[model samples]
Target chain A: GESVGLHLPTLSVQEGDNSIINCAYSNSASDYFIWYKQESGKGPQFIIDIRSNMDKRQGQRVTVLLNKTVKHLSLQIAATQPGDSAVYFCAEKTAGGFKTIFGAGTRLFVKA
Target chain B: DVKVTQSSRYLVKRTGEKVFLECVQDMDHENMFWYRQDPGLGLRLIYFSYDVKMKEKGDIPEGYSVSREKKERFSLILESASTNQTSMYLCASSSDRGSGNEKLFFGSGTQLSVL
Candidate 1:
């Protein structure tokens, strides 16, 4: 059974500090990874994504780092703000697969 | 923007009642998925359709069924709703151009409560 899991259930950071959310996946055949942010009562929103060919991908204020050897992935949010408080999840897609497996997610709290 | 729209934002039904959750995507995506999200359990796929009139069961599809009569519409059906089945249902659509590289576009989700 291939699955995706998060390292932490919750993470807290100062408003001006940086935040990192870690995830580990079990499927070695997975070729695509994505990070999603979900606010309370809303569906998960796409934040950033990375392919197996690339180790790191950066967005406007977020970065996704992937380590294929370790089957680990991380999302870094720079300059955490109050609006950044939400639940973040990591998802993996296997090659030639249609379904995406999602992690349990980590709740990020930013304190001003 | 790719839009996946769920028919309802909130729904309430009694136990043993049949429930229908409808999802429509404006984008002509070839793939559509239905997932249920619960606290600490993440999103569990119920069913997915790759094309019209074609469907496949997903990870947690024991108590659910699906219909994809039209290309843009996917429906999730609960034959007999139960209290344990109460959850937030999410609908997503993605293009079939890339095998595993397509990003999912999700709807706001429908919160269902069974009593």
Candidate 2:
């Protein structure tokens, strides 16, 4: 079965520092990828997404890079703030498929 | 704004009891999904409905069933709740556009604790 997994369970960074979270997916047919942030006691919220055709997509303070060859995905956050402390997850959508599979989340802690 | 509302924010049930989790979306989306979130596991889809009266099992669908008699509401039912069933349940809805290109709008979530 195809699955998405995160590289780390937790990441800690300074408030003003940059944070990078890595994810690896097993399904080669997945064409759409998304990154979501979940605050405590809340559902996952979409942050950014990238298509298989594109290598990278940029948002306000976040960036998503996708490497289909290696089946790796990464989310980078610039100038991390305390509000950025949350669990981040990477999700993959297969071509022509309706369901999206989500990876185990990586907890991000922005320390002041 | 698209709003997905779960009936309960927190629920407590005992073993062998039947549980129902309800979700309603106001966006008139064609797809609705139910997922469970655990401590180590992120979100595992239990079931999804693409249309009224149409339901499909997802990655982790054991001990669960779904109902979608209406397009705007999807329900998840637990036949016999167990301790392991204690987790955060999330409901999401998406448009009927391209198959995989749809972005999900999620509800806050319902935290269930089975004792």
Candidate 3:
């Protein structure tokens, strides 16, 4: 379950269930995509990243899918846990430039 | 691996008092940035420096200034703190070596409260 906030979206999921968070990027020319996770009192940590040339990339327990056609990016988490509850955001960067554009981010809440 | 350290986790200052926030990175990254995060605004870049002595203003630079006198340190200065300026400040750094080096490492952030 997910609720839209005034500025950020909230996603609620049960423990042991799979979760998918979606983001619609603004730039079609962006070549790199990244997913970051920020906890309650910590800075954002790198979760996973996918290049434009590739369609999907998988980490230990997370997967990132990139769709250049629609400028959409998604992060899939398997077997959601309480530790996985955090704010997830999408970021994009062009190949020739260093500036990265970030999405508004979605807050994931895990219900045990 | 890439550690960006901020001097303070929480700060309280009086209005009209000059405040300085220090950030240090050990990665020797060429690009360093300062951003402010709010409830609705997300992360807004305040200033960025691509070199030791060079800097560029980001989206919200009013009432804020930056100094990058050293390669590993970047400081954000508020000449006169205001109540409206109270927010979470984040410092980030990235490498300018070449393509595929655009991942930004961020500090834990400093929550500033101005009264």
Candidate 4:
């Protein structure tokens, strides 16, 4: 019954603008979070991750924000590009386990 | 680059037939996982192996069995394939405990259809 879910199913943003995708998780004890980018017909690729001890972590052009208090997670992309269009997934590492639970992905469509 | 390869890119099977999904990892990761990706359900783990000949049941392991005779190979077996079993199967590998949040490397996936 415990699940990780996203606030939106789809998001449309301009190529030059910024985009924010939100996720809500039911498990509070999850210590690690990761954001994955999955293109059509391709496997999920690691984007960025943030540990419970850290509130936020940044990658190439993306940032992952974790809020353990609200069991919320978010991914922010700066200056979204056309290549950034894909399904974004937020995964939570099971406490004391190597398994991770992924949320219903949010499809990001960046328009040029 | 870490590469996880699935045996098939696409497969179709008849209901009640046996199905075998093979996954092989080039990396020497100790952990190998089998997952099925479905819309709205995201990715649900079917099984995982932390060592050769050792396995663990995942969230949705029903209707599925796994084998890990070798460290570089993991297999998912569907005793009797059903229409509900049709979905994209993804194979992933990761390091064992204490490897630190090492990300899971996924295979291209096999799209299976049971009719």
Per-residue alpha-carbon lDDT of candidate 4 for residues A66-89, written as tens digits (9 for 90 to 100)? 888899999999999999999999
TM-score attained by model 1: 0.98
- What TM-score does prediction 4 earn? 0.97
Candidate 1 residue lDDT tens string, A1-112 = 9899999999999998999999999999999999999999788999999999999999998999999999999999999999999999999997778999999999999999
Q: Which lDDT tens digits does candidate 4 get at residues B7-113? A: 99999999999999999999899999999999987999999888999999999999999999999999999999999999999999998576347678999999999
For each candidate, what's the DockQ? Answer: 0.78, 0.76, 0.49, 0.62
Local error of candidate 1 at B95, Å? 0.6
Enumerate residue pairs that collide in model 4: none
Global CA lDDT computed for model 4? 0.92
Please give, for residues B1-115, the per-residue lDDT of candidate 1 as tens digits.
8899999999999999999999999999999999999989899999999999999999999889999999999999999999999999999999967568888999999999999
Clashing pairs in 1: none
Model 3 agreement with the true structure over B1-115: per-residue lDDT tens digits: 8899999999999999999999999999999999898875557789999899999998789999999999999999999999999999999999967785478899999999999
B42, model 1: CA deviation in Å? 0.5
Per-residue C-alpha lDDT of model 3 across residues A21-111, encoded as one tens digit per residue: 9988766677888888989988778899999999999998899998788777899999999999998878777786756666777899999
For candidate 1, give the DockQ. 0.78
lDDT of 3 at A77: 99
* True lDDT of residue B21, candidate 2: 99
Q: Considering chain A alone, what is the TM-score of candidate 4?
A: 0.96
TM-score for chain B considered on its own, for each of the candidates: 0.97, 0.97, 0.96, 0.96
